[model samples]
Target: MENKQINIGIIGCGRIAQTRHIPEYASNKNANILGYFDFNKQRAEEIAKKYGGKVYESVEAMLADNDIDAVSVCVTNSAHASISIQALNAGKNVLCEKPMATSLEDSEAMVWAAKKNHKLLMIDQNQRFAKTHIRAKELLEKNTIGKALTFKSTFGHGGPETWSVDGGPNTWFFDKNKSKYGAIFDLGVHKIDLVQYLLNSAVNNVSARLTTLDKKDSTGKLIGVDDNAISIYELDNGVIGTVTSSWTYYGEEDNSTIVYGSEGIMKIYDDPTYSIVVIKKNGEKILYDIDQIQTNDNQTKSGVMDEFIDSLIEKRVPKSDAESVINSMRAVFASIESNETGKRVSISGTK
Candidate 1:
């Protein structure tokens, strides 16, 4: 029921926790953020103090505390499976960040671990929660974009340096061992996931060309990870799409997705605002601006976290749960394979 507050714990007090999770959880009255755990004890303490919560030394300690109803694994890309699996086995529901895992085996294990423990496993693919994205998805489903033809989506920002509070080599975003596939995995995951989410389909095949173009560290040294990447995919629904993700953009935050259907075209962008533009076959264009739907802070779909809390209490599937995000992971891994082999990779058995 929505009458009681659910106890929540966060593992990995990194950029995600500091910016999104902490603020969102603190503002939501339905969830009680009991505390957080980070490898960096000082960072954990800082976040907990700021949120009126406590810091636990380890995930086990946090999970052992009976008050924690759920645990958010905000750790690195590689550790998502292990941390979430450990939390699930400990009888705590888990909400892990994107990419599920860097590889298929780990991703599947994370899913299986949740099933084995009968715990909820959610992937924090919050792009679908964006008002613009949700509105576009609705319009597509309503055939407002006509018989889905093809789509192009891209997410480009000025690298993770500006995005993270603590910049430089210290940031795990630059660690290949932790981050997996640079921009392709970091930013591409959202685009791939949103495509599947909006189309209600799985990528049937994928091909990619990856590059570490313009790689430069804080000191201007060459970095090992990729700075720009592109992937082409064919959805099971027969819709072909292209997804480009980069950490090399120099100006303006650009996250835009456009879909062209037999009847018209639909576009959604993040720069100007969270809004959707649809053009009908008759050449009539309609723009549904979500400026008013935005919260006082201009954060769109700030209610998604609340929705997750409500789903937990209602014993229902959360929007960002594994059942959906697994498809995104499939697309990511398949794209990686395509890049490595310089050929199209078929995503067989993917729904």
Candidate 2:
């Protein structure tokens, strides 16, 4: 018998869906967008009309659909747990956006729901799917950079107020309650998860300094959320890493990673279409242009969406499963704890 395409429901009709997730999933042959739901009914209707899908009046209605095999949650940070839990309890798989939840308790509940329902629960840590980061992971595994010694990775841009096409100062990103953290939560989660993925190692301890540098919101009013952050981490392998994330950087796109090891050095950057440059101890340098390496432009596709589709069709597990993302969340929570206590917090010994 031929396999039927898996039907998916989108829980949020926000920027992420319109920009990345929606386009990627719509292009995949193995997946079909069954419907979409948003708190703003108009937005959901608009996306559904434009994309040729149905609109559900509520998440409950979407969850009750027998055709919907999975739900991609693009909701704000605060709603991740509740929406995901409902979807899972309704016997549907989940593809949730990053920073999993606002607090460890919420994140734990989401994971519990997935496990209880025996459905796939994936976190959209798309940075792991980036061509640059993938190449770096391969090089690390190959020891092309030797035994990893220390690492530094960063992702930053001007505040999100100007990032969206609408240019509203009222983005969910500016809401500390909705976003959970600041730039660190919005952008830092990607790099932090990437560090864990590339090294395949756990972070043991972290000391963080979080600050709200640009106190003004999009409307130029004082905002309480942090705008800049610096965090130092000790990896389980004894390698140390320092991550600096900010929404106030005025220069170029600051997403890069530097890896130093006993045998060589490796660097990945995106100034151009993602590339990896490696320097060996023997004084030879190898440059990999990821765009050229990734035939069929696989690098440009939505890795999370593609993987989710593959997992559905192949009946296999995606590497970026809920448990793995939860580990990254542990680090994020640790940083917040450290920031509040003004001392280093150790994740290794925590529950």
Candidate 3:
């Protein structure tokens, strides 16, 4: 298998599949897309025609194809677990999209299926692969900044309407049945996973406020899911931080994370001139002009696809595997519980 290219199948032909998964897999030398499936057959046909793959009549057909060594579960949030599980059970590795699943139980089930089938289950937590974030993690690991105390991480944009395949107010993102969550799951999950990865700590407590601020359906009614979320997290290591996910920022996107340590503060994607900045207690400042963080408008090769392919060929677990990302998914659910109960939720033993 090391010398053979992994045959890939995409389960959804939505915006994410077309823009990120398909192109990334096509660029990887160890992978080749073999099939495509979507609820909209025409959409699947179009993607297959453009990307050099066969269109499947149904997801079951795609999963049954013995030629496909793995499948990228790029469907809606609610279907992620079921489809991934099916692929795993069918003897194919799975690379699931973010938010893994709508619930912890479903996520665990996906992991269980992968383990039972002895297949790889990787999640697309792309933020951790960004050059800026990789550098920040290295700096933190090296103690470039002393003990990290508190931090703020934010991911905001106009809305998913500008990014989804449908490209309107009626995209599945606003529908709770399809998305299961809005800004929190769509955007917050990425930061939550990245924070945990960088700090080497799991979030143990969460308090949050989720609201529907501006987005509405074509009928002018408020969307069923939250448009904005502000969550405060306390990690197992006693580091505290705030995460804000919003789809209402009308200006330029604000995707930044800043950590304050005893010796200095580390800022990522915050400064206009630098990709990362560190300020010491003695007033010494350091600036790093690394590559810019990838955005929706300026898409870059998310190291995710390459890593997934390499992991399969090397017969090793990927960095963002399902088990590793489960805690981050737990934090997202915990934040929702805090919002509904109007109290801080503890995720210490929920794992």
| Candidate 2 lDDT over residue span 308-350, tens digit each | 9898778788868888887778888898899999999988543
- The C-alpha lDDT values of all candidates are 0.82, 0.82, 0.93
- Judging by TM-score against the true structure, name the best candidate: 3
Once model 1 is optimally superposed onto the true structure by TM-score, how far is the C-alpha of residue 2 displaced, in angstroms? 7.2
Model 3: per-residue Cα lDDT over 1-351, one tens digit each: 789999999998998898899999998888999989999999999988898989998889988889999999999898999999989999999999998999999998999999999999999999989988999999998988899999999999999998888879899999999999999999999999989988989999999999998999999999999999999999989999999999999879989999999999999999887999999999999999988888889888888999999999999999899999999989999999999999999996633
Candidate 2: C-alpha lDDT: 0.82
Shift in Å, residue 95, candidate 2: 0.3
For candidate 2, give the lDDT of residue 245. 83
TM-score of every model?
Answer: 0.93, 0.93, 0.98
| TM-score-superior candidate, 1 or 3 | 3
Q: Model 1, 9-67: lDDT tens per residue?
A: 98988877766777787888788999988888999888877788898878889989988
Clashing pairs in 2: none
Stretches > 4 Å off in candidate 3: none
Q: Report backbone clashes per prediction.
A: 0, 0, 0
